[model samples]
Target chain A: MFDISFENAKLFKDCVDAIVNLINEGEFEISSEGITLRAMDPSQIAMVDFKMPKKACSSYKVEGDVKIGVNFEDLSRVMGRARPEESLNLKLKDSRLEMTFKGKFTRRFNLPLLDIGGTVPKEPKIEFDANIKLNASVLKDSLKDASLVSSHVVLSIDKNSFVIEATGDRGDVLIETKKEETVVIAHECTNNAKAMFPLEYLNDILKGADSSTVITLYLKTDAPLKVEYPVGQAEIVYYLAPRIENV
Target chain B: MFDISFENAKLFKDCVDAIVNLINEGEFEISSEGITLRAMDPSQIAMVDFKMPKKACSSYKVEGDVKIGVNFEDLSRVMGRARPEESLNLKLKDSRLEMTFKGKFTRRFNLPLLDIGGTVPKEPKIEFDANIKLNASVLKDSLKDASLVSSHVVLSIDKNSFVIEATGDRGDVLIETKKEETVVIAHECTNNAKAMFPLEYLNDILKGADSSTVITLYLKTDAPLKVEYPVGQAEIVYYLAPRIENV
Candidate 1:
């Protein structure tokens, strides 16, 4: 039997929202330690990795290692129907995933599992020269401003500041956060790193973020950018490849 | 000069939200009394009528009778950017409608006027045998429940109760409000009146509805349904034609 419960259904819903856009379907490895999922998007331009430890849940139980493949869209629809104050219970039964929201009224949904075909992807390897940690709201707000101007945004880090810039026919937006701003938790850079990535992907990834949460950014010149944030007790990481010019 | 200022931008925004879906563009008549708009949906399935009296605005000024054609979608987009606490000022200048939101940051948008070719529709006339008044929330919640089952909803009123029903392949939902539900403000019917209307149009008209808001329903067998509600000092009314089965 595999069963886990969360006191806050919103947290579980949020965790699913964080990765559902990046990957349509994913195989989750469930064990006594935790539940983990890592996959690359169909276009191979982005990768998503997440881990929710057993302790993150109010109650977690498992008999052995179980691999479950799920269609993210179906799960998202089920979560959307859940009330904010409801608690959630998830169970794996045969080929169906059972999700139950317990509150004033009990609502249950059975989601059909997809066949992932046992395709396992290796961990992505990348080197970064700059790491900046700041408030999630800062990133979220900057992304919104960027989206108004362009479909892609440029991220660059200087010695003491990180900047987000977007240029379009409409207008250009530049948001710079210095080290003195309390929003910046840490700013470390051996050398300046700059990259351009799609703004829509970042906006989708930050949909569930609020001002109180913290996000860390890993950047390298002309390489993929990594954004890390926490969902409940789980840690979600996303890597988006940069757009190359005439390459 | 034609200028009107609102103490609360959200009130004006809500008024536009109530009808934007059914009517794309509308010709508004500005006079000493206030501003009024009457338009039918492109498909002629719904009719929307709105009146914002001079008392509804903090200030109202009009030199003479002025007719301005406006695209509701553009106006709605501008309103979406307005904060709840922001006050709004609207001005007509040289065939352009200018909207300004006063808040932390003053944002201005100039929307171009459309050429409606001086066509004004006469007010719709319908005979109704039944009149029902209920809390907007009850109707809103019932429509949401109905939408889950079907795109069309059946509304019927008998001697003692009002009923809403939707049946689809997925399932069927029936909501009945007894004469003493407290939500039923007034119900008068000489005979039973039953009709089926598109749920989406009704849903759009009630998007900004709250529990305290009262919505009056006028119904006739196989005839259009008339829903009237208040937005601030303005009275907004919608008439939706019934969907005949197998026609």
Candidate 2:
């Protein structure tokens, strides 16, 4: 039996919601180190890698390495029905998923297990060129406005400004913030990278990222974008494939 | 030039929201007698009929019948964004729909005429039996629970109790409140007459219905349910088709 417990079930639910919107399902690997999950979309357009350390759990136990198949969408829905103040208790039974939330009335909901006949990919190793920390709410607002204009958004970072731009047949949206804002732009080798990615993919993946939470982004030229947001004691990493601009 | 004004944009928005959700995409006919619309779903499973008398309008000016094809969904979305305290103005300009909301700043949004390419049915003449007054919030809450079990909910009103029961493959949900606590049941017959209707249709038509506001329901055995909810000087009526149940 493998189990990890958290005081707040809502926080875990929030993290699952953001990642599930990007990927359909995942294979969670239980180990002595921690619980780790890494997978990409069917078309390899977007990726999600997550790690929940032992510290996040009040009680952690793992007897052997086990691969548990989980449908995040279903899990998120069940988690969403829980109250914010409820202390979350999760346990895996014979074939059903059970949750006990502590609130006005302790309630339990059961969800049937899904047998998605497929194998998830392992986490990829990529060298990043730039690492930057930015405020979560600012980035969310910029992306929301840009999405109204185009399906794909372009993020171009330079030494002094963090710029987000999107243009389509209908209209165009541009957002730029200076160093004084949450934007801390740095150029090591005068490298200016512009990557275009699907706005919906980014939006879905960032749903779990709280407005007050700071997000650290690892960027590279012509490669997938890596975004990491802390969820309780867990770290959720989302990688999005960039759309090649033919110009 | 045609114009209508409301102090709160959200008030109008809530009313329209209930209407659009009840009826499918269809054209509405505006006449000197006041704005009137009636239509049945494509499958003819449900019918939505609405009318506002000329006296109810702030200003009624219609020399001839004007058929305006306003996409209720699109119109509802624009209206849904309106702030609650803002003064709202709706007007028709040539072939366009215009809405102006005043808050800290006056904002205007345009709605292009839609070519839904459909017809609105003439109002049907049907006699309804058993009309009862109810608290809107109590009805809303009861329906909310019933929807969790099945889309087709059976609503029964007897001399002493009003019951809503929905049983599906998932589970069974029953909400029964007696005249002693929740409602004052009135009837011509003491026997039980149950009719089933789509939950979403009922959910939509409850917009103008407030907690303390009284709602008049006209019902019969296997006949469409009629709900009348008042908004300011206007009263909107919704008739929903019923689903035939085996049990």
Candidate 3:
């Protein structure tokens, strides 16, 4: 039996939002340290790594390291029912997931558990030549602008600036941020790097990142791109496979 | 030549929202006094009457009384592109409707005017025994609650209270506001009145009404229900035909 309470449910809601777009089912590993979920999309095009520290919860308790399988689409719908200022209480009982939002009225949702029938995907190990930290909004807005022009965007970083560009049949969008720009918090590059990835995956991952949040990017030439951001006390990392030519 | 401007486009946006669910196309009558639109849904089950006085617009102009037909769906989409604090400018160029939202960047939309081949429907005249003014939220909340149970709601008023009720196969919802409740502003009922109207129409009409806004209801036994509310310097009225049991 496991029970946990959050001061505000927004963090968990955002965590579920980050995964519901690409994954249908996954398992949450609850341990004394915190909760961790790592999964790859069915298409093998992307992977998600999520972690929430136990200290983030107002109250957290666990008997042992337990893995709970959940259908993220249903989990997101249940989380959407929470109020802005309401506290969220989650309880696992009799193979059912029960969520209660403490508001003027005690609203509750009982959801069925899913059998993932598999283990979490192993995190791929790769070396990167460029690591940059910037404001989440800059990336989000750049992705949105690129989406208006094409389905995929090229993420490029040089010694001077970080760039996002998209070209389509009708138009193209280009966004560049130099290190001097306040939007770029930190930058380190050993060599210039560029990689093309599906904009849809990046767009979905940005859903949980707010404007003021800080986002870090790890990239290498033609290698997978990793985007990381923190929500409350939790950290979310997404790895999007680059769109190689001739695929 | 016609040109008009608004400090904030929210009034026009809300106006379009009030009718877009029911009426697809309609004519806007621009006069020295302000702007007015009246149309009936294609199904002939509901009619929308909208009015915005000159005082509502930052600048109002009309060479003469001019009528321009517009597709509300397109207009609503255009208005949605406006930023929260952007000013709105509308001009009639040839047969095209040009709308510009002035913000950090001027965003413009050019849409073709539809040939709304007919004149506006004549307004219906009916007598009612009850004219009650109450907090718009009471009505809005009641409709939302009823929608969770059924597609239609029964609105009733008598000497003591205003009641909204809905019954379906699973469960039922009942919301009642008595004279003692501060929500009831000014109520006059000479006799009992009851009418059944589709909840979808009522729900859409209440979208623009905030909690502080006043909503006036006109009712009679088994007759169409009339709902009226104010947005800025404008007044909007909707007439929804009642579903008679034997009709």
Candidate 4:
């Protein structure tokens, strides 16, 4: 048996939002440490890793480690109803997950658990050649600009600057950010690296991030891209495979 | 030749938004008085009367009265791009409307005139039995609440209160505001008035009104409803034919 409560629903709502776009259903592991989820998209092009430590919760109780499978879409819809200041409570009862929000009034929702059978996928190991930390809005706006011209964008990094470029029948969009710009919080590059990725996946990956939030990115030549950002006290990480040229 | 400019684009944009929902295309009359439009919806169930006074424009010039036909959908789309602080300039050039937004940058669009041939509809004369002025949001929210249960709502006004009621397979919704309530700024009833109106049209009619704006309503038993609201310095009026209770 496990029961948990959060001071506010924002953290949990954001966590579900970060995963729902990529994974339809996922297994959430609850233990004394807290709640954690790792799942890959149906197309296997993207994966998300989420962690919320026990310290972040207002109250946490558990008899032993247990795994609960849930449909992210349904969970997202329920969570979306929570007001910003409302507290959220979760409990396992009769093999169903019961959620309650406490504010001016109490609201409860019961969601049935699914018997989803699948082993957790292993995280990819890659030695990135460059890393950069920048304001999330810069990346979000660049992706939107690229979408007007092409379905994919090429992210490149060198010693002097980071650039996003997209070319299509309509036109081409190129956004270059120099290391001196305040939007680029940090930059390090031992070797120049570039890779092209689908714009739709990248857009969904950043949906949960606030414009002011700082996001760290890892890139390499013809390798997957790694993105890490904070959702309140929780941490969310995403890995998206690059679209190799002519492949 | 006719030329006009507004200190900001908000007023003109709002005027277009108020008319676009009910009338797809309309002929605008431009003269020394400014601009005016009178058109009926395709179903002939609703009519819109809009007027923008010359005093509201920063500059106004006219040689004589001219009627220009336009597609409201296209006009609305272009006006939607204007920022609140951008100044708007409009002129008749080569039988087309030339619209330019000036701010830090200058953006212009040339919309070809259409020959939308239709005589302006005459406004109906009705001696309303009851009249009330209330906060726009109160009416807007009541319509939305009623829509959850039925496609149409009954608006009733008696000596002491104004009520909106809707009943359907799902459930029923009833919202009553007493004359003493702050939401009801003014209320008068020589005779009880009640009429049924379609929710979709009512919803669209109130789309352009700000929550704080005060809207005046005139109603009578089994008669059409009349509503008037202000879009900045401009005035917008709408008349909606009621759905007769029984054939």
Task: Note the DockQ of each predicted structure.
Answer: 0.05, 0.04, 0.03, 0.04
The local lDDT score (0 to 100) that residue A29 gets in candidate 2 is 77
* DockQ score for candidate 4: 0.04
Best by lDDT: 4
Alpha-carbon lDDT, every model:
0.84, 0.71, 0.83, 0.90
Candidate with better lDDT, 2 vs 4? 4
Q: All candidates' TM-scores?
A: 0.56, 0.53, 0.57, 0.55
User: Lowest-lDDT window of 10 residues in candidate 2 chain B?
Assistant: B182-191
Q: What is the C-alpha RMSD of each candidate to the true structure, in Å?
A: 9.7, 10.0, 9.6, 9.1
**Model 1 ranges with Cα > 4 A deviation:** A168-173, B1-247
Candidate 3, residues A112-225, lDDT tens digits: the string is 888776767888898899989978776776676566547999988999888787776434445677767766789989999999999888887777788888999999999999
Report the C-alpha lDDT of model 1 over A1-247, residue by residue, as the tens digit: 6899999899889888887878899998899999999998888888888999999899999989988888787677567666768799989865677777775444455666777865667766887999899888888888888989899999999889999999999999999999778889999998899999998888877766677888889999999899899988899998888997786
Looking at model 1, residue B223 earns an lDDT score of: 88
* Model 1: docking quality category: incorrect
> TM-score (chain B) for model 2?
0.81
The DockQ value obtained for model 2 is 0.04
Tens digits of per-residue lDDT for model 3, B75-157: 67656555678798888876777677665434445667877768778888988878789888777877889988899999898
Candidate 3 stretches with Cα past 4 Å from truth are A1-210, A213-247, B145-149, B167-175
